[model samples]
Target chain A: MYVDVILNQPASRDYRVYIDQLETLHFDTKVLIVTNTTVASLHLETLQKKIEAKELYSVILPDGEQYKNMQSLNLILNACFEHRLDRKSLLIAFGGGVIGDMTGFAASIYQRGIDFIQIPTTLLSQVDASVGGKTGINNSYGKNLIGSFWQPRAVYCESVFLKTLPKREFSAGVAEMIKMAVTFDKAFFEWLETHDLEDEAHLKEAIAKSIAIKARVVALDETEQGIRAVLNYGHTFAHVIENQTHYTTFLHGEAVAIGMVMANILAQKLTFLNADEALRIVTLLEHYDLPTHYRIENVEAFYDAFFLDKKSEHAVIKFILAQGIGGYEISRNIPKEVVLEALKEANA
Target chain B: MYVDVILNQPASRDYRVYIDQLETLHFDTKVLIVTNTTVASLHLETLQKKIEAKELYSVILPDGEQYKNMQSLNLILNACFEHRLDRKSLLIAFGGGVIGDMTGFAASIYQRGIDFIQIPTTLLSQVDASVGGKTGINNSYGKNLIGSFWQPRAVYCESVFLKTLPKREFSAGVAEMIKMAVTFDKAFFEWLETHDLEDEAHLKEAIAKSIAIKARVVALDETEQGIRAVLNYGHTFAHVIENQTHYTTFLHGEAVAIGMVMANILAQKLTFLNADEALRIVTLLEHYDLPTHYRIENVEAFYDAFFLDKKSEHAVIKFILAQGIGGYEISRNIPKEVVLEALKEANA
Candidate 1:
């Protein structure tokens, strides 16, 4: 199955996201496969055999989120220079979000942009990161603080690659899938409640459904100016959670899962989501063993951190709240006391 | 006077290039003016006084092409973060090509791209670099080997900024203007022969004319997929010249001036230009005291260097040769011996 990401952009920038469809790819240009040590060790040969290029090279980066820095970015770029990859050359991102983001960022700036393909190995990346063109390395200030909205040439997602995924990591990917379902598709949310993703056939359908929703949202607002922000249903809170825990305690999707529950609390305050509706979402996340709670040590400190988020402009925090199921509200000017109340509730 | 660069891109990407027009500007968001030491010492205050923002900051990098690297780019990006500049904030590139390229590149990646204005200080920048959305920093491999096609929101070109420009630099700027005329406008080329740019009014007219030509060419081919390569009429030879001299002997425009002469020799070989037409170009370049000749040390080495240029793809050098004045040709498969003979003649 495949989802066409029809971005309301130049036809050149629009691409498709294929689910469980990894075909024999061929290119007449220099091709660089950028993967991490973990993915390289497990699945590099599988990916390598599928691609035939005039020149093929792979750069193995150390696996982990912490390695997603300028040093790694330079490693990818230096590899391009060393291999003499030109503007027409291509890059294949063959790992999780870290590899995809770094490879996409490298392609965006290499010779003022080049074509890059995303072969997402992790479910987290396949469902979310690989679909969006948000590519950048982190700085001392924050995550994805520096990046470009450079879309990929195409994205290939294969379920076979996920056979080796750790159980926790697999659940983390479900968090993003759940985030998509809760915000945009109550039917998808209901589908998740009834179906078991552990079954490969059911998992493929969910991935396609989630990517289709994401593609539609991205098409509406490629730069996250409007409806695209709605896709960040849990990210506003998730960013703060990740930063507070130094990104070591929780996977990004796991934080988003907890973030969704926290956002549901705020939605209850705003009457966007009823208690029963919020409970259903939490029950589904827990079914997948996804974390749906967090301890906020200092509500004030967390509140301050929202102002530092890239989405929060000029001290105005845009909260993405679930308006019951399959609906959302972007609350830009919610009173501080009301948010503090929700934070207190989430803390409890 | 102003020339609107109507890029066939999204409406948000199209911008205007204002010549001899630097007006008071205001922004509701934080603004950072990126300049260099030399430009800051002379005109930072001039530029700063004309802009009012909620918060204003300036980062003065060391001046020169050598400083146009990752370090300077980092300095600008770090300042944006330090000032807490958000997505809505703006950057003003206030210097020559080096500052403009670095600043524009920083804006392109900072927070996944933001709005920036160009206030070009040098004649070379005002007429050329400031108008193009090409933003990048040089690396160990080559000049502008890494960058994005990020157009600025607007460009303000004030001849007043040129008051402090050295005479040699001014002539170098003229080399680019001459290049624009020779490739796109025969009438403009003829007018350039009779007119004296040393006169302020004539210089302003020439600047506007050159920019208008650039604006038209850019509008047609924003990504240099086709006709835009014509703008690099002299650059094919110039890159080699710059590389050979380690970029210390001549300004970029000066090197381009010599490169134009070398290209003309090749063009004459192809019967693209008569001997008189070629001499006219050389005479105009010499009239401004721009370097019209560079003795090639090794014809074979210089020919090999062309392949290293980013424009060269798959070891195929695409030479942008003048097809007499006001016309150009993008020759993809020029025979080796013919080009070698031209190089040998230029060697003399």
Candidate 2:
């Protein structure tokens, strides 16, 4: 039987950044912040000031996508061990998706399971990764193929952290915002069409709307069994690009930006989406300076990667094709010819 | 809101246990069996006979408690990467508790998560580890410091594997059996008093009873929020003892044997149990020749280890003390002095 896991809403907190002060979010024990060098340089002090606990410690790891593997997981576990962090000690995932996923996973595994709070500092993380409780590290097999549906005790999405984010990074974050809009909220989709993401007010509103959309989807389908897959609208194609490029070429949002465009073309070809709607998506993505297409090196090799993806399994590719801008249908046993045609359009 | 996650039991399957039949469980995908050299030598041929996957492989790790750590976890993860186990493949954990814990943990993080089955080859593992979804490796801080509550897709328990087990190992499994009876089933506990564990019929009944108790408890409290902590009737002291002895000095069950004896004394002192009931427990453990005590070289150091235990936090240690043979209570805020006194008596 499926379970409806509650998603706790973030509480109100003043937007401030420092190296380390003492405030009480009211946890009963020590708190350990799991982050890396990059985040430590920028916001660790700020986070330290905001969180008050009986005891507080920081474990800084070497930062990079390359380190998002089992070795990094070991490092996180080691920190928890060394600190004697028990089931009572709270783990704060203080970086972006990689840190959030790894730290949440560490908390999930530590002492069988423990409480963890998400203090997501990246746009991609605040709107997407922080909500799902999808904790895992990437392996050679594929991204997020191994993970647990372990949610956090609370999520502190302080938009203040976005101040240091690069323009491209902010736009990449917008990609997921747009995906959520396209798959679930047409009003939000329309809002994105008219607003410039560079406007911080508009971006905050978009992030909130996007997260709410994701929250609704997740509340209905916590385990990604049905409606939750809508969140993966562009991710299927995006994961291949991310893997093929060794996850270095495209910021996750950038890959999804191109992936969304490719998916739109496939939707249009199959009459799942109108040409005008597809064009509108492409136009908006281009406005953000997000790549809308990529060169395909080898068709079959690229096609082979889809089978390796966690989404498509048992030789059945379950494609999330749009029924225009606001609706999606998960199609299964999708023929290779149709997928190949979509791949060609993606390359084009 | 508290969410109860219940696992629906799948129909059991009959599996062939041969040292050479590992391939039959796979379907054209890579298969990796994370086991130690001891189990590999004893039953690899039997496993090999069943494995007919596209790629069949094994990584025989160093056999023993010392190897159940982060370095070994890294080794297991590295083997997965080196062997190139894909997303669709499977990992079979084919040893006792250490193997099961490490392998289950490795699978949990291998790609985020992967499918794995437990082929528990020891009585301790077959009756205990195989039933709970508790998968983890130990750390310097304490046992099972890093792990997940990840349930296996299936568990294959073949009583035939026990034939090769040493006498001490067989007795260790019975300790868990005794634990199950003491906590949940009073009638079962009384029956155990008369039945010899060496008899095959009684052994099978005991194993089934132990599994059923664990399965019920786990089904009710998968993440150990409430009543499930009662299952750790002796683990509070067991972890401390195991930690002090460096885990190599005794099998987990043997430590638990001594721990149960210590807990009984504590229970009697707390007025929750009578000495008569405690003595009956001592007599049963003695019948199996399981160690009932260990000298505490340093009482302060042993006490320090309890704080490092995953179950302990701050100054409070949660102890599972029995009211009598069939009644249990999870006592938190257990004073160190009380625990020390029990330890002193057990040692004497």
Candidate 3:
């Protein structure tokens, strides 16, 4: 039987994460589980127990963003073909956002189209990547510049896996949560200000809220035609940081945390957000031990990379700026000088 | 500006191929022409003159079905990334079916995705692969078991390319047209029996009709959910032949020609198609000098290969059978003994 988990915007439901029981889904087809070392070591057993298929296998890829390249993607696809998984087979993306993107991409290409499910373990993934069907791998040029807006059949966000997540990794997930609250829901942001997310109940509620907001945004604009770019509130500068460091130094959400501060500074200068309000947001980020700034080795190179972003067009950078906390606007053709000034102020 | 070509089903309008001036469509972004050695040598200069882009370059991959594997697919994708071709950069698939599939797949996965257009040169591709958005490369396990249903931004079908195609290759293309007619349009099948494809105008009309039918079928069921399976009328058996022959012995259309005969025999035995009608289809195939049978090394092994097909459900084999000349049905769980009998008869 098929189950539809639709709840407002970012719906949250308690999902079971087990292994070797995939047969219970009543699908008599091949099941390909795409994952990396980190999740494979931590939760592969449980996932395997939940997937008891007639022909079940795992594509264990290299861990980390560095390995999230075309070479690794090809390796995963090769594994899919080697296993003879047909179009009816289900591909389970059993890892973080990287694994989800790569496996989703594999499923998207395998026989031109096939079914895939998202089993997001990381908090960041559970709240964001697992919901929308945007799948892709990174390139030397940029992240997610070459990808598809392919959605998954289902998503299983098992909070059970997050228990093993390191404090820093868990906080990285919170950075994205904060992004959702700040841009989409002022009420949610106010709740976060008073609530202690370290508490289990509060954290779960926060995840549900974040996912609900993201889901609503995605459902309304699956292809990022309009409101979806608001979802990239901090991604503009974050992508530059990730690119500058070659995706090695900072976690994605950590970089995004710094990016949010940069965006806030820009918003303040544009009179979109008050300086005191922006400072409060930064102070809250520090409360979670998130970074608020990053050093750029080459400003010109960093600035140039924005044009190469998937969201950019004809040298026009699509920047999602806040009109104020809990409100955002997607602006195109923001002058290079304006961006440069923001960059300077962010560094200052 | 973007152009969308919709080939109208069953009409000659879709068949009459036209070569529009490529220079007229201008893009500031880089334009990448992906092709093989054979096609490049013959038409690269002509194609280059047509493409007036700010930045233009070509990546000539090794030609032939043998090279249509993951290694080559990655080579094409890596080349695009290495060149720093971002999302705006357009990939032009400038060759036959292999080039189209591999190039489209490469573009689909680069950074998540980039736009691609098809310029099919082979008769087989013009009537078949070029119309559908299915793009992928072969793998160690099977042919086209890995790929995505990525539609091209536009498709340019210049019938002028057919003048250079080998006679055997031209016959190979006829195989798919026959499959389309016999399974979906009986009138078209009768027309093929009485007409010779040597007539360029008539051949173009048949191609256009077949492609229009394919495009409509694919558009309705882009993900192969239902009626789309009809497109695989001969592919079920053709895949086994290609796998057994290591994809070196026969052009894809040639193998498909032999496959249609097998499907016809099966349809006759099941009383879905009359024996006399099957003979008429075989007679038309003979006129084109296409293969109607094959020498099987091992029937069991050949049957085993069907399970490896992308259409199969787990280990279950699926067959597209005709109910009379133009009627079709998708059936699975057919007795293995019956399939083996068909394979033996195909060899006989």
Candidate 4:
């Protein structure tokens, strides 16, 4: 299946996203596949056999989010230099979000910008990271603290890559899918309340539905200048939790799962989402085996870090509050005391 | 005088360039001035006083082309992190091409992208570097081998900064002005042949003319996918010379001066530019006290490195040959033997 993403900006670009099985990938230009050791071990042979190019090379990085730093990013860029890859070369992000983010960031800077494609292997990456033009790596200060908006020439997402994903990671991916339905499509959220996602066919449909909503949001606000903030419905709180835990405690989707719950509570306090509506979303997260609660070390510290968000302006931090499932609003008027109260409510 | 450069690409960007005296700059956003020790020592105080911002900071890197690498670029990114510079912050490139290139590259990847204004402080930067959206850092591989296209919010080209530039640097700046004139504006090239650039009025008019041509070419081909290659008319050979010398032998504009002479020699060989026209251009460089000749250490070695250019496609090197002056073409028709002959001619 092919989906189109329109970046209605200067030097207007539109790219096709292929989601199905992997086909023989070949390029007439220099090509580099940036992958991690884990992914390489699992699928390198199959990928190597199926892909052909004028100059195809691979740079293997160690797996895990900890390695997503400037040192690791340089591995990809240095490979480009060592191979003498020019503007005509292409970079293929062949792992998960970590690889996709780093590869896209590298392509964005390689010779002032080159072409790249996203082959997101993980469910989280397929539905979120690879779809948006947002690409970055974590810094000592926080997650994705460094990056830019560089859309890929195309994306090839194969569901087969998820067959080997561990149960915890698999569940984490579903959390993001649930987040999408809750934020944009009420009927999809309602369907999730009764559907059996364990079925392969059902899961694929859910994934596509999630991607379609994300594609719509990105098309409207490629730079997150406005409506795109709604896509970060749970990311503001999620980034903080990841930062506090050094981004090593929970998978991104897990943190975001709990973040959505906290947002629901915040919305209830403002009378935007009633108690029943909030619980319905939490119950759905539970059904998906996603975390719906989190504990804060210090509410004030989290509050201060909130203002440092890439989405924030001046001292005002915009919050995405749920009006009801599939309905949300971005507001900067939430009282600090209300946020502090919500933190206490979310305490373990 | 104000010049406008319209980037008609994805997320099209347009900004005005102020090309006259220094004016007080006041921005409500957090701002950081990324400069080198030499340029900062010369104008930091004056700049600090004239620029009013919510929060202002400075990162002083050592001055030189050799320092334009990833390490120096990180200094700018690190300062941004230290200040907790959110997306709303602005970075001011307050030096020559090195500063402008590094600062603009930093802003392009800082939080995946942020706002930056170019405060180009040298004549070369005003008429050349700051006019285009090209920003990058030199890696061990080559000159500007790493970077991306990131347009600045605005470029403030205060010719007043030229007062402190040493005589050699002053001459280097004039070489770039001559390159712009020779490549895109024949009238401007003719004006340079008889004009006294030492006169401030004449210099300002010359600088404005160089920028106008650049602004027009950039508007049409922001990515260098077309006419933009004409702007790199002299850069191909210049980059190799700088690479062989480890970017320490001469200023960028000085190397470009010698490179233009080589380009003219090749153009004459192809009958694209007659002997008189090439000599007229050479005489203008001499009038500006710019080097019009360079000796290649190894002609064959230089020829091999030419294929490594960001402009080369499928091992085919494109040459921008002058058809008289202000008229050019991007051609991949030059044979290896012909290029070798021209290289032998450039040998001392």
Ranking by DockQ: 1, 4, 3, 2
1 or 2, greater by lDDT: 1
- Where does model 2 sit among the CAPRI classes? acceptable
Best by TM-score: 1
Could you give candidate 3's per-residue lDDT for residues B264-292 as a string of tens digits? 87777678889888888889999988888
lDDT of 2 by residue, B1-348 (tens): 011224533222212222212235655778888888988888888877877887888888998887888788878877877776756678889899999988888888766677787888998997788776788876666567678867776677767678889999998988988888898889989999999978987877777777777777877776677888888888878888887776679988999998898889888878888988988998999899998888888777876777665565566777898888888988887777887787677667
Q: lDDT for every model? A: 0.91, 0.78, 0.79, 0.85
Over the stretch B1-348, how does candidate 4's per-residue lDDT look in tens digits?
A: 888887775444688888774578888888999999998889999899988999999999999888998899989999998887888899999999999999999998888788898988888888889978899988666678788888999998887899998888888889888888887889998888878999998988888888888999998888888898888888888988877887678788889988989988888888899989988988888887888777787899999988766546667787877888888867786988998998898774
Ranking by TM-score: 1, 4, 3, 2
TM-score of chain B of 2: 0.89
Task: Mark the regions of model 1 whose C-alpha exceeds 4 Å error after superposition.
Answer: none
Fill in the DockQ of model 1.
0.77
The candidate maximizing DockQ is: 1
Candidate DockQ scores, in order:
0.77, 0.43, 0.46, 0.68
Query: TM-score, B chain, candidate 1?
Result: 0.98
List iRMS for all predictions: 1.3, 5.1, 5.9, 2.4
